[model samples]
Target: MFVHPAALCESDQIGPRTRVWAFAHVLPGAVVGADCNICDHAFVESRVRLGDRVTVKNNVALFNGLTVGDDVFLGPNAVFTNDYNPRASVKKTEDDLLPTVIRDGATIGANATIVCGVTIGENAFIGAGTVVIRDVPPGAMVVGNPARHIGWMCACGRRLDADLACACGTHHGADPTTGGIVADDA
Candidate 1:
């Protein structure tokens, strides 16, 4: 039940356990689900919709036309822009707006900037400080700017080894090698 002084919202769909922190604003038409944490200084625009168990950390902004699925972890300082190309003096129309979607169970690390019109797949993990300009596949793990898929990640956010396996049951059990896990399945 923690409410920040700077957050202004009139949305009626906020879940029970969600906390809105300092300087964070959820606009009137935003829909946020249960147990989501909107951390410090985050801005969620009116058209943004967040599903259950989403975690939006400090300094993150979800502009209009963004849809975040359930169990998504948006790391600190992550940014999403609704426009693909913009000049400081240009006025864009709704037709020019792009939608950014983060699928279920995705984890975006700190300082990641996801460009418009990208759909991050389910359970994909994007490392910190990465810049994503393309769609990320499900269960994939990517890092660095323009984010190349380096490996696969478990739904738990553990990076799978080169053997396409981990100590976790996911390594040698159900859900094997689905996230572009390439290498020896040792």
Candidate 2:
């Protein structure tokens, strides 16, 4: 891993080809996977786990209890909260914190606020400045305050048509169990 001179990477668990940029702070016990780009001014807490090929953009703060899957893209200034009810006087333990899971190939847009305990499904796309209060389904495209699901997206990052077909030649169908879109083969 290549840690910039101005960056403070206390973790020994960073994988190969990962680059920690200037002013970024990756605390000890954080597990960062290979080929990840930790942009400038990002803060990664100790308990966070980042999968391979993840892109954490500038000014992002990844707190404890966050699990980022492979190929996830965290946009600049995206916010994540770990506590549902936070109080300065109350010192809560790690177990009290709720976990947020960002599934593989998901893209969290810039300035979006993701509330704790929600699972963003695979290839989901969160629009910029959106506030996510609940779980997002796979291939879902969400926007606005409280994060309404507006449409479906392909894993290749293209919006799916009414028939859930993308120009990228991928076809998806709604999963009956979860009401989420999934590839036909999946």
Candidate 3:
């Protein structure tokens, strides 16, 4: 729990060994887990839940209804939207906000915009500056303004070979039924 004096962590639910850096603000009711890094100038809303060892980079904001799983990496300035049809005239309640879930080991690249109501699957890799509008399958690697699956990634963060084997000697494959990839050992 190394919270910099410049950081404002109003949450009592922060786990041990987490570091909140300068200018970061963790609002009350936000649950941050152990060994997580809340980087400089990051903002976490009340309803956001971050799991263990998650890395939230500088200038990123985890708004309400967003849940980040363990070991997730959020790149610099990554944006998340909670409202799909936001209007200045409308005052929306918490129930009106859409939810976004980033599963364990997923990596969202710098400046990516994750739209609400999507589940980024386990170990999914989102490239820099991507605008993700849909659910990303497990182990899928996507890029571009409207992110599209360009390749598959291994759980160890390497691009998978054609046979779905990694250099690290891990074997993974896509599930035909769920359309999600899974580690064979799992």
lDDT of each: 0.84, 0.97, 0.95
**lDDT of candidate 3 at residue 51, scale 0 to 100:** 97
Candidate 3: where is the Cα deviation over 4 Å? none
Output candidate 2 Cα RMSD. 0.7
Cα error of candidate 2 at position 102, Å? 0.5
TM-score of each: 0.88, 0.98, 0.98
Least accurate 10 contiguous residues by lDDT in model 1: 177-186
> How well does candidate 1 score on lDDT at residue 45?
88
Candidate 3 per-residue lDDT over residues 18-117, each given as its tens digit:
9999999999999999999999999999999999999999999899999999999999999999999999999999999999999999999999999999
Across 128-161, the per-residue lDDT of candidate 1 in tens digits comes to 9999999988778889987998877876667776
Give model 3 RMSD, 1 decimal.
Answer: 0.8
Candidate 1: regions farther than 4 A off: 171-186
Give the TM-score (vs. native) of candidate 3.
0.98
